[model samples]
Target: MKETDLAVGNTTVGLSRTLVWLMAIISGLVVANNYYNQPLLALIADELHVSESAAGKISVLTQIGYALGLLLIVPLGDKLLRKRLILIDLVLVIAALLWMTFARELWMLYVASLLIGATSVIPQLFVPIAAQLSNDQEKSTNIGLVMAGLLLGILLSRFFGGIVGDWWGWRSMFGIAAGIMVFVWFIIYKMLPEIHPNFKGSYKQLMLSVIELARTQPVLQLASFRGAMAFGSMSAVFTTLVFHMEQPPFQVGASVVGSFGLAGAVGALAAAKVGKLQTAIGTYRTILYSLLVLIGSWGFTYFAGETYWGLIIGIILLDLGVQGSHIINQTDYFTLKTDAVNRLNTVYMVSYFIGGSMGTWLASIAWQYAQWEGVCAVGATFGLLGLVAHLLLSRKIRLAAIKT
Candidate 1:
C-alpha cells in the first residue's frame, strides 16, 4: 500500500486484486478522453458547420497532441511523483473536456482536443506504476492486465462518445465525459498507491537514454517499427470505417460504427489471456500469427463488407490482430529495460503515435482514391511489411536468444 514497501529490493509489494482492478479502472477512464471525439466527429462537424472531411482534423490534431505528450510528458514519470502527476493530468483533462463542451467553433474544439490528448497521458503513468508495483516474475502479466484495461478504454471510448452524442448531443457527450472524469478522479485519488521515484535523471540524460536504447536494442528497433506499421494498418481501417459505413453502400448509424468496440473487446480480452502464448512462443511468433489474422481480415472485406455477419467477423479479426500484435510488442519492449521503463515507453509509444497518424492520413487519401478497398490494401500492405521485417530479423533474433 505504500511506496517504501514496494522498494523492498525487487520483491513485489503484494497488491490485492481489488486494488489492481480499481487502479486499472481509473486509468482506463482517464485515458478514454483521447478517443471521445472520434465517434462523434460527424456530429461535431455538423454542429460546427464543417464537412466530415474537415472534422477529420479533430482526430489528426488529437493524435498529434498525444504524440507530443508521449515525447514531452511521459518521460517525467521516471523522475517525478507519479500519483501527483496523474492527479494533475486528470485535472487538466477535466478542463479540456469542459472546453470541448463549451466550444462554439471548430478551431476551439481542436485546441481543446490538443489539451485533452496531452492530459490523457494518465495511462502512461499507470504503466510505470504497474511495473514498479509488481515482482520481477509477474511484470509481463501485470503489464498485460493493465494494457487490457487500457486498450479496452481506447476501444470503448468511441462507443461511449457516440452513444452519448446520439442520445443527447455532441456537446452533451463532453459534458458527460467531464462528469465521469470528475468521478474517476475521486476514485483514483482514493485507490492508487503513491509511487516514489526510482530514477531522477535530468531531461537531457533521459532524452539521450532513449536514443541509446534505440541504438543498442535490436529487438526494440524492430518491434517499434513493426508496431508502428501494424498500428498504421489499424488506423487506416478505423479512420475509414465511418466514411464507408455512412456513405451509399452501408449508410450505417454512428451507433453501429461505435459497436466495433465489441470486436475490440474480444481483441483486448484475447491479448490479456494470451500472455502465456507470448511468453512461450515469443513476440515474433505471436506477431506473425496476428499479422496473418490482419491479412485474412482485410481479404475478408472483399466478401464481408456488404453483409452484416461478414462485417462483424472482419472487425473481430481486425481487432484481434491489432490488439494481439500490440501486446506482443509491449511485452517484449518492457523486458528490454528494467530500470528505464519511462524511456522505453516513450520510444514505443512514439512509434505507436506516428503509426496512428500515418494510418489516418493515408486512409483519408486512400478513401479519396480507392475507397474502402484502398484502405484494406493499405492494411494488408503493412501486414506484409511486418512479415518481411520479421523474416529478416529471424536469424539475428534466434542467435541473440541462444546467446542469452
Candidate 2:
C-alpha cells in the first residue's frame, strides 16, 4: 500500500484508548474559551459602556481572530512541534482571558477578545492530532468522541459563563475560564505526545502550497461553502434569540438564556450519528438531508412567534441539523488531504468564520427591521441556497466518485 494509505489505515485500531480520552478533555477545555463571552454579551455591553450592537462585535472580532489563527497558527501544526505549539497557544489564550477580565475600556476588551480568538486554535490542533493518531477503522469514532467533547464544551461555556457572571461579575467568567485553561495546560504538557514535522518547507512555500490546495480542491471548496452557509444561518438565529427571550413577553434571565444551550447540546449529539451515516449514505446525500432539516427548523420558528415550546423545538432541530452537517463537512474535508490537515483547516475555517460573522451582522440588522421573522427568513434563505448548491454539484460529485 502507499505510505499515506498505510498511515490512514493504521491510524484507527488498537491505539491507547486512555490517551484518546485525555486529548478530548484537554481539547474541550481549550476550545471552551472561544464561547465564554457569548452568553454574557448583554452583561458585557452594560459593564463596558457599549451598545448591544457594538458588543455584538465581540462575537465577530473573536471569530475573525480565530480565522486568523486557523490561517496562521494551525498550518504550523504540519511544520513545527505540534505539542509545543498547543502549549504556547494555551498560555497565550489564558493571558488573553486575564486581560479581558481587567479590561477597562472598549478597545482594551476588543484587543483582548481578538487575542483570545487567535490563540484559541487549540481545538483545531487537537482534532488533526486525533485524526493522525487513530487507526482507520476507529478514526471516525475517535474524531466523533473528540468532537463530542468540543460540542459539549461549546454548549456548557455559555451556561457556566451566565451563572458565573450572574453570581459574581461578568469579569469573573473570564477569570474562571482562565483558571480552567491553566489546569488544562499542565495536563496537556504531561500527557500529550509531541508531533514531528510532516511538510518541511519555507513558511512562504508552505503557505503557497496550502493556498494552491484550497484553490484546486473541489471537495474543500464545496465543504467550506456549505459549512459556512450552515454556520452563518445558525449564528443569525443565536445572535437574535437572546434579545427575543430577554425582551417582550418572555423576559427570561441570563441563566435561562444560557440554559437554552441545552437544546443545542441535545442537537449536537446528532453529530456522532452523522459521522456514522457518512459511511452509509455518502456525504452529499447526508448534506441534503441536513439542509432540509435546517429549513424545516426555521418553519418551526414561525410557529414559535407566540409560544416558547415552539421556539425550543425549533432551536433543537436547528442545532441538530447544523451540528450534523458540520461533522460531515469536517469528515469530507479531512479525507481530501490527509497530510495537509492544518492548512485544510485554515481554508475551511476561514470561510466558516466569515459565514458566522456575516450571519451575526446581518441578523443584527434583520432583528432591528423584522424581529424574529427576519432572522428566520435569513436562516431559511441560507439553507435554501445550500440545497441549491448541493444539487448543482451533484453530477460533478458523482463523476468524481466514479473516477476515484
Stretches of model 1 off by over 4 angstroms after superposition = 1-14, 401-404
Candidate 2 ranges beyond 4 A from true positions: 1-15
> What are the clash counts of all predictions, listed in order?
0, 6
In order, what lDDT does every prediction score?
A: 0.77, 0.79
What local lDDT does model 1 show for residue 71? 80
TM-score, candidate number 2: 0.93
Worst 10 residues of 2 by lDDT: 1-10
Best by TM-score: 2
Error of 1 at 354 (Å): 1.0
lDDT of 2 by residue, 215-279 (tens): 88888888888888888888887777767787888887667777777877888777767767877
Model 2: colliding residue pairs: 11-134, 11-135, 12-134, 12-135, 12-136, 13-135
